[model samples]
Target: MSIFKSRVNTNSDTYNKNHADSLAAIETLRSLEQRAVTTSNKRRPVFEKRGQIPPHERLSRLLDPGLPFLQLHSLANYLVEDDNPETSIPGANLICGIGFIKGVRCMIWVDDSGIRAGSMTKTTMPTIISLQEIARRQKLPLVHLVESAGADLTTFLVESWAGSGGMFKNLARLSAAGIPTMVVLHGPSTAGGAYMPGMSDYVIGVKENGLAALAGAALVKAATGEVADERQLGGTEMHSTTSGLVEYLAEDDTHGLEIARDIVGRLNWNTRAKPPKRRPFDPPLYDPDELIGVVPKDYKASFDTREVIARLVDGSDFEEFKPRYGAATVCVQTSVMGYPCAMIGNNGPIDPQGATKAAQFFQLCDSANLPIIFLHNTTGYMVGTEYEQAGMIKHGAKMIQAVSNIRVPKISLYISASYGAGNYGMCGYAYEPDFLFSWPNSTSQVMGGEQASKTMGQIITAAAERRGEPVDQELIMREEKRIYDYFTKQESAFYTSGRVLDHGVIDPRDSRNVIGFALETCLEGRNRDLQPNAFGVSRM
Candidate 1:
């Protein structure tokens, strides 16, 4: 691995402008994630009065002190119908992330119950399913902080409800696959939602506050004319003493978290398997802050991908996989935070040769068991017959095939444009990267808005010519504007990320740390040992 020589002139006016733009984008990402918390915090008095711990606070307690918690999908469903997209404070009413619990890495899922009592929204189930999927693959223990209000009846969507069965199915599969799944009930989990604790390997419920029931008292009475209250019907006491649904009953939220920690410790998770040693070298030679200056907010603008790799890999050392061959697709073998991995980034369009280069690279990396980092910045597979005859489609498919079937962890970053087949080739969301993140300025769509509108304009003109009619330039202009506006609105990082397209929008400067954390998590999961059974832990 040779050191990447510096080329970015950070002192230039262009770089300075880029730096300013990047800062604003980062600020927006930070603000949106924080807005979700402040909105939930508005009900602090109500929760504290009821002897309940707020969701975020409970999460803090459960995680190891001072250790980083990679918050995922922070801005899930940020924009809503009829809300001003510009200022919409988005949250799925759930706080989900990966963090360490008692030195054991686990997926932490908390219901932001403070917001609408952490009601189940359309975004809720998918978010959890994504988290569960990550937990299953990463071999992470699932420790959920349950406190959701049941389904969001007000804005119910049949599709979400129909698809929700997969969530429980995944939970069952996690435990069956020898991954420990635990849930602590801090408050009410009613109706279908109660199944979360039922499927977990460990269940801890807060005494009076915890309630898991098929129906709350009002619903129960409405249907069966029963007079049982929540506490009497599904409190921790009853579950622990009589039904045996709850294995541990705690006095309060803090106490429940304590019990969860004790369970993790007792499981001897760390002792089950030896963690693979990693040679942690020094930080990148260049300042990560230079990343902002190096990457223009305009996704179309060209910038060397090595500028990013330099800021990310240890000691700015990039082992270029192929220096001159198929140069548009930059392939490199590198180490992020001492954990060895290979990175594939796009310099421009994925040409036929570049596509094959990347395909071969993915195969070699997978064989070496090194995690692959994808920095998405391609305009997609190159167009034009010169490349098509060169087998662009098939070659691009080979890259996608390799990315799709690779067994090693795939971590992706949407650095800029992630368009068309290039997205799939670079391991986009549908490819299911272990962690998918985006920079605030990143834009993703089938193609750029300008490009799509122009292509449509050309088609409209061609169709008009075929009919031997006068060119309707007005209509063409109208259609092009419409196409451009539609694509532009949806291509923003905020818009796609709000839909949970990627994990969340991240700051350019933190890419190294974030990627390193993901790599470490994947490594631990691959090595950790767990007890497997026919069904989820018997009692659960």
Candidate 2:
């Protein structure tokens, strides 16, 4: 009976030990599962949700399908304050990467205004810096889609006090590097948030939806005692006309996006992978006799020079760039006799303050490897205190710089009214145009007839006052006419005497043949991209 009791106790002890071990193993698994659930809820990856795809998917759908996206700073993430948690909004507000549009790759950043007004915090800086580094290394295009209230107030103190650098330096570096950056102003982007767009290569504003500035209207009113609405503060029409800050105004967001694509298509670096194919065009011949009818005998009489350009270039070939920006000058890309050529001409009626856009157009031509043909008829750089205030000196210098750097052929045709800086700026011999030709009545001088009349009128009036006698009107008129005739006749000889100033004077009837032959010879062995290299690398 004793031996049977011991055996039963041993069996029970063994059973109890095995049961406890099984319970512990089950509890450990349950603990791991609970921890996993907690982490899954806290850290949400950017995968698609149950009912919706993300903004990136929508963007891809909007652009070309089957295009691959190369994400920049994909691992770096945004930080959300506890007060502005995900429950209060959609999530941490940032969508950033480098992607392709129609197979052309670019860096893109989209702000989510749905969450925390798309404010920039310390956390967002890392992503921007990463994108900047990539842009510098690869020389890819950068595009910023802005929709922000401003920087986050919660993190502003930390940023100002801590060891942190702003994004302005990086943006300026990229711009100077010629990386071809673009900004899309979609919604309100105020203060530091808008500065990135302002500093970009091209700033695009969507009509009513876009707004950008250093401060909001309310803040501006408080700071400077100025009362204005949001549009007056930072609107497309206001900046496009008044400030000259924004470039390429769009009707809406969709249009703004499309403009971004077109601007990229027009850039030199953006299409470095392949050369642009030349399309066929037929430019009408401009008879030398026709030139006589175009310019009136009087210098003051104005005629539409744009019509002359249209008649000379190929059918509807003129694609005017920055037309509204520079009214005093016209810069257009078109084909003359089915060959690509850039035409720069003088157009009157530009605001005396805004003449420097002409120089910007010249710089763009140089960068794009396009040759120039100057049609000379400019009064001079627009004169006024407003022009001085607008930094016209600095801007006008850029034209001289660009013309000097031009390696391709440039031809100058002096029609009328080429004087002062205008004469030098419009591919004059000082700036070294490859060929300088002129019409029969071409006048290249420092000033014009009316200017001579005014100076002589002042002199006559002053002499009469000194003698205590009445002014002699007939004498003044005769003196003015003599001065005008002397200068006009002398200036016309710039092309005739074979001086350093003139290449040759050509008849209007032979104008077409002259240009056609000149272009054919000048354009030979051009386009450095097609040349053979021992190492098979492009040098241009």
Candidate 3:
């Protein structure tokens, strides 16, 4: 492997400006995240009055200390209920991530019941379903911390309710795939939600607080003349004694989580070999913190994408593939966290040569069965008549096809712009990257706001000319700004991430470690053997 030399001037005026811009953008991201945390924490007093700890407290108790937890979609459904970021809560009212439990990697799915009793939002179902898919794909045993009031009826969508059958069905699927599914009932899992505990392979419930019933006590009383309390209907004791829904009943919530840890400890998962042995390597030569300044704040400004790859790869060493042939498209053979992998990145728009180059590189990586990391920062595939004639369409299609078919794990990271067909070719949200994440300052849009607005202005101005009338330049400018705002609002990493577009928005410096964790998970998932049976672990 060739060592990559650094070209970025750390103290240059341009670099300093980039650094300031990156910090502001990251601060904005942190502020939004803190809003969600504060909003949830407000319910602390309420929980304390009831003698129950908050949901996150339970999560922290469940996971092993000091081990990494890969939190996904921390900002799911941002600005959905309200445009005012100060007042609205995002994150699907769910704490979903991957973490180690007793040294065994497992999916951590905790309901943020602190927020309106963990009511479902518009994006809640899809976010959860997607996470469940991730868990299934990675073979991570799923452990749910259940406490919910079902759907938020005020913001209810009938389609969401109808589609929720998949949530229950997924538990069964997870079990059938020989992936263990467990749940700790922290509160009510009533109505159709009752199946959450019913379908799990293992279940722990807290007495006096936990309940899982086809109909909650109040619902049962309303439907029938016979009245019953929740304790008699679906309390942990009742299920442990008669219904067989809960295998373990605990004295309280903390004890329930303790039982869960013990259950994971007994799985004997550590005995199996997962990922390949780590290769020897040194840390990257440059500071990873320089990632903030590596990409210019202006989306259109050009920067060497390798400046980024240099900060991320092992020992700052990598071998560039087809360097001079399609200089715009960068493909490098490198490793993250001492695990060998390939990196395909964009320095500019993809031309025919760039597209073909990427396709060939994808083939090479696939043949070697090495994981591929896609670094996105492109306005799009180059356009114009000359490029069209050179077969940009077909060549771009070939690259997309290669990405789709690669059996090796694919991870997509948006370092900057991810626009138009370039997004598709780089394994954007739709292509099913094993894991996808973006920087706070990055964008995911069809095109840049300025370009989109200018094009709209041109179309409007052209129509006025055809009508034998003059268009007002001021009006056109206002129209342009309107279009610009619309596109920009939807494209921010915060906006798209809230809609379940990316796994999460991350600090640029943490890119190496975040991608390292993902690579490790993917490699282990790919190699772990599963014992498939006809049906999942259903209660006898």
Candidate 4:
């Protein structure tokens, strides 16, 4: 493999400016995450008083120490519930991520019951569905720390109710697909939420706090004139002894988490196949801290994407694929954390040659069974007469086709801008990459705000000129600003992340660890054998 030579000037004014800007953006992300943590932490006293562990603490205890946990959608419901942003909470009242449990990689979903008693918000269902999709595709075992109080009836909508069935459907699919679903009912899992533990392959319930009933006392009294205490109806003792809904019963939160971990350890999940051979790998020559300076805060400003690759891949060693042919679209074959992979990044727009090069590279990785990582930062495909005449459309289509049909694991990270069909060509979320994440400064849209404004303005002005009508300059300027503002707001990483455009916004420094984990997950799925059934295991 060829070692990638560095040409970046770390001391230059441009690099300093980019670094400062990136730091600010990263700070914004950090603050938002801190806010969510602070919001959840405030309820710890209450949870402790009730003899329950906080959601985050439960996750910490369950996961293997020192292992990387890639948290998803940390800011899921930001500024959505009310006009006053101060009162609105993020994270959809849930804490979900992928982490190692007893040396087995698994998806952990914890209900942030400390916050608002873990009421289900509008964003909750979609977040759970996204987690399920990841678990299914990546073949990761799923562990749910259930403590939700079910849906908030006051804000309920027919659409949410109709969509809620998808949660249970995915759970069933997971079982049939041979992915184990382990759930611990730390608190109430009533109404439709009762199915969370019922559909799981392994269920652990805490003694007095655990409850899984279709109808609680209030609901039963109102629906059938039957009165019963919640614990008597569906507590740990009742489920474990009477109904057999719960496979194990624990005395408290710590015991319950220990039981869940023991279940994962006993599954023999990792012994299904021989583990991949470990290879000695060198760390990148460049300091990962410099990653803050690599991606410019201003999306319009150009920077070398290789500076990014230099800090991420092992030993800064990268064998360029078609370097001279498609210079703008950089395709390099490199290893990440000792795992062989392909890295595709953009120096600028995707020209005809770039598209063809990327498509061919995709096929090459597929042939070699190497996972592909996308570092997205393109304005999009090039346009205009000369490029169009050169068959840009057809070439871009070929790139998209390769991305859609690739058999190997694909991961994407939005380093800066991901616009237009470039997003599709680079394996955006719509393409359903095995893992999709974004940097704090990343933005996504059909096009840049200024580009959208100018394009619309040109079209409107042209029509006015053709009609021999006087153009209202003020109105046109106002219209352009409106379009620009709209795109600018929606293109933010936070906004896109809140809307579930990607998996989550990650700190750039965590790129290598996250990518490594994701690649391992995909590899496990590819290697493991599953005993599939036409239908999933049922309660009966």
Instruction: List, residue by residue over 408-435, the lDDT tens digit for candidate 4.
Output: 9999999999999999999998999998
How do all models score by TM-score? 0.97, 0.42, 0.97, 0.97
Candidate 3's TM-score reads: 0.97
Per-residue error (Å), model 4, residue 314: 1.2
Q: Please list the Cα RMSD from the true structure of every candidate, rounded to 1 decimal place.
A: 1.4, 32.9, 1.4, 1.6
What tens digits encode model 2's per-residue C-alpha lDDT throughout 451-538?
A: 8677888999999999999999999888989887766655642222222245444444455555544454345423212212232111
Model 1 scores a C-alpha lDDT of 0.89
Query: Which residue ranges in model 3 land beyond 4 Å of their true spot?
Result: 465-475
Query: What is the per-residue lDDT of model 1 for residues 1-540, given as tens digits with 9 covering 90 to 100?
Result: 699888988789889989999999898888888888998999999999999888889999999999898989987877743247666767788898998899888889998988888887667777888899899888888999999887878887888778888988998899888988999999999888888888888899998889999889989999999899778799989999989999998999999999999999887788876786689698999999789999888877899999899999999997887779899889999898999999989888989889999999999988999899999999899999898899988998898899999999999999989999899999999999999999998999999999999999999999999999999999999999999999999999998887888888889898999999998888887887777878766672
Off by over 4 Å in 1: 80-83
Which numbered prediction scores highest in lDDT against the true structure? 3
* Number of clashing pairs per prediction, in order: 2, 2, 2, 0
The count of residue-pair clashes in candidate 3 stands at 2
lDDT of each: 0.89, 0.59, 0.90, 0.89
- What lDDT score goes with residue 241 in model 4? 91
Off by over 4 Å in 4: 82-88
Residue pairs that clash (backbone atoms under 3 angstroms), model 2: 288-508, 288-509
- Model 3 clash pairs are 77-498, 176-536
